[model samples]
Target: MHGHGYGQPVKQPPHTAWLVFLRVLFVALGILTIGFLTWAMMLRLAAVTRRSLDWGLFVAVLAADILSITLVAIEPGDEIHTTGGYVGILLLLCTLVGTIAYYLAADIRHFLLQQQAYEAQRTAPAYGYPAPAAPYGATTVPTIPTVPTAPGAPGMPSASGPHTPPPMPHARVPQPPQPPLTTPPPQRPAPARIDQVRAELDELSDYLRKQDGPEGGR
Candidate 1:
């Protein structure tokens, strides 16, 4: 070996190290993409909006990283085999779709709840009773009467003389008769079978004994 050009040293290309660096870089990028997407999906499902642009920014950054990784891998002398990168991109896409679907479902549920509340309110009874009828020859309908207490009632201010109770207010139009409350039919109790219950208890006891035996016990 010394006879041929005094044993020259072999020069290794820097491109080999660069290739290794590219591989590590792509792998890290892919892992980061997957982790970020998972976190984003969890936030979206939980309906957390404090970050405001979290969804948009997550998508943008993921897409940019994917594109950059793809371009780097495609470049000459940068032979980085990263199937993980493709998998990561797929996972990110799935997460984005899931987040959107979750939001839509939540929105629909909220809208339905609001609509039901509105309908309940619309069907609810008014706060007070209807106004009383007008007096004879009065142009306007009479206002609802305020009750004056009887003279002899406790805590009541005495009137000048013995007081007569005010006449009950009547509606101008007759109301439809209310339907009577119907009692629900009573359910008959199931007939008991002493023999059947005894048989079941016997079977359960046999199962328990078998389970407690040393050979078969857990």
Candidate 2:
């Protein structure tokens, strides 16, 4: 975000436990200016840099070193050697300046912004109780809470109305079963010709008796 249209820097490194420990170690060792280079090498090995290694801070270091050496050599009666204390002092000073500038770079600022947004989103949890809704005959639309997100990321939009739990199904009130009905047994139907049939049967028996008692039986 430093005015012009420069692309974003390398993505932030993963937040693994070991990486976090190493970051803390390198930060402490940064006092001597070697830690920056070491960390840069690690990032390079991890292929995290998109544009420049060490976030282009090494350029400042190089420019400063050359300028310091040239100024020192130009002085009268000064014989500059690679092993001289002047060279070491100059490199350390340049590295320190480069480190400062690196922290102040546009890419670093953007990264820090992203980090803060991520932290804010994480600290404010997403799984809290749903926003409370107004009861029956409510006057206002209840404020439905939503999760927060970092800039440029997907965001949670509040619901048009408050969230309410679904109504529970009504339990069936089971009734005790009723006893079966009882009735008198039905009567047998009376026969229509029973008395007439009995009279005919008696007349036939009398005819048989008269035939057996004939007086003229030869």
Task: Report, for every candidate in turn, its global Cα lDDT versus the true structure.
Answer: 0.53, 0.53
N/CA/C clash count, model 1:
0
What is the lDDT, from 0 to 100, of the residue 118 in candidate 2?
65
Q: Which digits, one per residue and each the tens of the lDDT, describe model 2 over residues 93-208?
A: 65655554453353344456666766655565333434456698979857997665544444543344444679999999999999889797896555646666777888888888
Model 1: lDDT equals 0.53
Model 1 C-alpha lDDT per residue in residues 33-122, reported as the tens digit of each score: 543433343344244333446556455545654564564456455443566555545555565455445544553454455556555545
Model 2 TM-score on a 0 to 1 scale: 0.27
Q: Name model 1 segments beyond 4 Å from true.
A: 1-81, 125-218
What are the runs in model 2 whose C-alpha is more than 4 Å off? Answer: 1-23, 32-49, 52-55, 59-84, 104-108, 116-218
Which window of 10 residues has the lowest lDDT sum in candidate 1? 5-14
